[model samples]
Target: MPLFSNKFCPKKPTPRKVELSVLNKELGPEKALQDLGLEIGPIRLKLGDQESLFDNGEWLPETGPVSGTHKENHKLRQYVQQLEDENNLLKLKYEILLDMLTQTTAESHLQEKQMEQLQKQVLNSSRIPRTKR
Candidate 1:
């Protein structure tokens, strides 16, 4: 069955057995493999054997700046903090706007009521009958 693969990375047929082709080219000095604790290449066995071969290769050192991993982590942490700060600032601005809107609405309502009361007072005073001289 054909398997789906990324366009950038086409799938390759897994070799059942790996072989040593040239003396100096693909296969170097045999002692180098032994020193690295890698099983002799041109090897054949179950697929699981490949894992050990991969593990045997040299890895990053225990100390020193390793591939700027710490720097990346620091940048991520700072970014999260900055986002949080901006979110909080937005919330504060939203609350202030809401409060301003509430105050303006209340002021307008109070003015409307006062205007109605003044109109009623004026009408009542005019309706009062004046005594004839």
Candidate 2:
């Protein structure tokens, strides 16, 4: 009987070892592997490696301002404006109400004076004392 069968044979052979130095120099190791669609978690460099190569090349110095912060500031300003408008409206309404109350009070006082004069005339004609004990 035959010990091996052709069914178990691999369709393609894979290379086990690769040249690291040439690959590292050509693609700077990080970019080369990324270009090939490889994902390596944070690359750790040896103490002897070049510091500039390890530093992130895409760092920005003055990131300026974030849009969210500006948006929040704008929203805060709008809210303050709304509150001020509400306060002004309430103040105007309060003044109108106060004026109405003052007019009502003055009218009530005039009515009270007229009623007192009518009562005095009725008492004088009927000869009755209007004094309260």
Candidate 3:
């Protein structure tokens, strides 16, 4: 009998360690780590002659600051502010619509009551005796 047989082997397959380089190439370092349920760590990147590190979720160049980083940050802040403003505006509009709906519902109920009263008056008038003119 062979040493490695289906029946002789364990039911579950053994877990194997995957190389970080391979994982980076195939699924990117961040996504691979996330899929493996591992804690996120700084990523290292080699661009031409420079080696940069991505730490704290931000890219840090070994040489010097990259252009447009500040501009990007400003744009992001503006976008967040705009979204908040729009959200507040929507909330205000929703409250106004709710108030309008409540008023309309109350007016509708009042109109219905008025119609019922008019119907009752007409019925009562018809039942009363009238003298010939």
Candidate 2 global CA lDDT score: 0.72
Local distance difference test values of all predictions, in order: 0.68, 0.72, 0.82
lDDT of 1 by residue, 97-127 (tens): 9999999999999999999999999999999
Candidate 1: deviation at residue 7, Å?
78
Please, what is the TM-score per model?
Answer: 0.45, 0.47, 0.47
Going through the candidates in the order shown, the clash numbers are 0, 0, 0
Candidate 3 residue lDDT tens string, 1-133: 7787677555797899867888789998789778987885678887776567787788666543443565577689999999999999999999999999999999999999999999999999999999899
- Model 2: ten consecutive residues of lowest lDDT: 46-55
TM-score-wise, the better of 1 and 3 is 3
Candidates sorted by TM-score, descending order?
2, 3, 1
